[model samples]
Target: MFPSTEEGPEDDSAKHGGRVRTFPHERGNWATHVYLPYDAREEFMDLLDTLLFHAQTYVPRLVRMEAFHLSLSQSVVLRHHWIHPFVQALKDRMASCQRCVPRAPLCLSSPSPPRLPFLS
Candidate 1:
C-alpha cells in the first residue's frame, strides 16, 4: 500500500499561520466557490449613498461596497483534472432551478450594531 502523503490538519495550520484553509490543500488542487452576482440599480445606489452618509457620521472609516453578491456555496477544493467535469455538473444541476430575480425594493430590518474598533 502507498503511504499517505496528505498533510495533517496541524501541519496545514502551522504552514498557514493558524488560519483555517477554506479547502484542504492538495497537489494540483485549487479552492473554488460560487456566488450569485447582484446588479445594483440607480435607485439602489441612491439608497446606499444615503445610508453611507448617515453611517459615516457614527463610523468614520465606513466605506461603500465595491461589488455585491450572495454566496451560493461554501468553498470547495477541486483537483485540476476534475475542474471541467465539476463545472459541467454544476451547470446541469442549476438548469432545473428556478431563476431568482428580485422585483421589490430591498429593505434592511433591525440593522446590526457596527463593531468598529472605536466602539470596542
Candidate 2:
C-alpha cells in the first residue's frame, strides 16, 4: 500500500527557534550534519545484507541503507544565505581536531538506542 499524501499543520518551532529541528522542510534550505566516515568492506556488506534479509521478513517495507556513518552532530537546518559560512565553520573545527583512526566495528548500545551494529 502507498502512504498518504495529506499535509499536516505547519510547524512554527523553527520560526521561534525554541526547539532544535530534527527534520526541516523550508524551501531552499538544507539539512547539514557532521559524521565520522568509514569504508565499508566485504565483511560489513555481507553482515548488512544478512541483517536486511532477516529484518525485511518482519517489516517488509524496510530498506537497506545505502551509506552508513557515525554522526557527530544532530541535523541542523542551514539557510541558503548561511550555507557557506556554516560549512566553513565546520571545516575550521574539523581541521583543529586530530585525524580520526578508523577502529574495528564496535557494538554501541544505549538503554534506549536503536538496535543495530554501527561501525566506528
Best candidate, lDDT: 1
lDDT of 1 at 107: 49
lDDT of 1: 0.68
Tens digits of per-residue lDDT for model 1, 33-116: 676788887988999999999999999867788787765555666789988987787777778888766777564442233211
Q: Among all windows of ten consecutive residues in candidate 2, which has the lowest summed lDDT?
A: 111-120
Write down the TM-score of every candidate. Answer: 0.54, 0.60
lDDT of each: 0.68, 0.66
> 41 in model 2: Cα distance from truth in Å?
0.3
Kindly provide the TM-score of model 2 when superposed on the true structure, using C-alpha atoms. 0.60
Tens digits of lDDT, candidate 2, 1-120: 234765544878656434556565766688776677767789989998999999999998666666778866556566899888776766766676777565665654443332212211
* Clashing residue pairs found in predicted model 2: none
